[model samples]
Target: MPATRALVLAAAVICLAAAGWLVLREATDPGLAAHPVPGMGEMNAAELSRDGYLVIPAMLREVYVAFGATEEAVIHDTLAAVAAGPALETLYLDRAGAMAGGGLDGADQEIHEMELLDLASSRDGAMLSVNATWRVLGTVGHAEHMHVRGNVYSAALTLAPTAAGWRITGFELLDVDRSDAGTMVAAPEPAEATGG
Candidate 1:
């Protein structure tokens, strides 16, 4: 009778050991690459530090909108500028990965490159001495009448974090130097010199 009891106890121990191994494997799997972004249910500023850079693509869109590149990039008889808007929107939405599913035109659409270097609280962050550079150029549909190319542009701005998320509290965009932020001008042909 004692031998029977011992055999049952040993089987139970083996089962528990196997379950533990499976849990450890899932937690330590590096190649699988899980839990990149934390969602609302996942955590807040406490467990994960709200001061972290919750890099949402929408914030980047807000900056783009503030710059108003849509009108500048497009020219008469050209489609490049018009297409860039939707394409830019697509790029930002993908940053959230598959878990985010898709992005809508709301608070989620206003986030961009949010590299939170400091976290004052789980609900707030500050970036007074922040440097940021973003460049995006994409073709619009299929058009041969124009080209979409420009020099790199950089700027510095101070961003702040709030309950809604990170925001540009204050910023100064110095000389663009040489940027093709659209605003292309057409060239004129010279008049006949014989009459002169």
Candidate 2:
């Protein structure tokens, strides 16, 4: 009876050891990549931060259009889709609502260029900071016709990965430079110069 009990206890120990090994393997498996953006799962902290920066412009474009259109439901949906945490989503939705409420018949925004300026990451990979330059065309209210408002924005972003995917945890506009859109004039034909 003593021998049988010893054997049973040993078997139980072995089973627990095997289960632990499996869990460890799954946690550290380098090949297990799951990310919505292709090639993102393979990126290290800096690279992930850069990629996260690149994705922001696209997300902003969608939300801007939705808000400009005064589609509250769309704004809520877009914010929820891009931002993961509940607090973050609510904050963005409120901002979007404000933009929509701005005195304008309609507005259109386009991100002309984006460059990742810098990135910092936490040791545990739980947080990231991304600094970037975003050149944008801000088309505000129309007069006779739509006009362009050139804007260069310096943005600082905090990002994290959640169950849904990568999302913006924080946002700050560091600086902005604005300029009036230049007017273009048509060239005169040679026929008028000759008095034809």
lDDT of each: 0.36, 0.56
> Backbone collision count in every prediction?
12, 0
Across residues 19-113, which tens digit of lDDT does each residue of candidate 1 receive? 99877765564222222221223222233333233432234444444332223232211222111243334433333242144322222212222
Q: After superposition, how far is residue 44 of candidate 1 from its true place, in Å?
A: 9.4
TM-scores of the candidates in the order shown: 0.31, 0.57
Q: Write down the TM-score for model 2.
A: 0.57
- Misplaced by over 4 Å in model 2 are 1-34, 37-47, 50-53, 86-124, 143-145, 180-196
**Model 1 bad stretches (over 4 Å):** 1-58, 65-125, 138-147, 177-196
Weakest lDDT window of 10 consecutive positions for candidate 1: 74-83
Candidate 2 lDDT tens digits, 13-101: 99999999877865675223334432244344445655654565655565455555545566566665556575366556666656656
Best candidate (score: lDDT)? 2
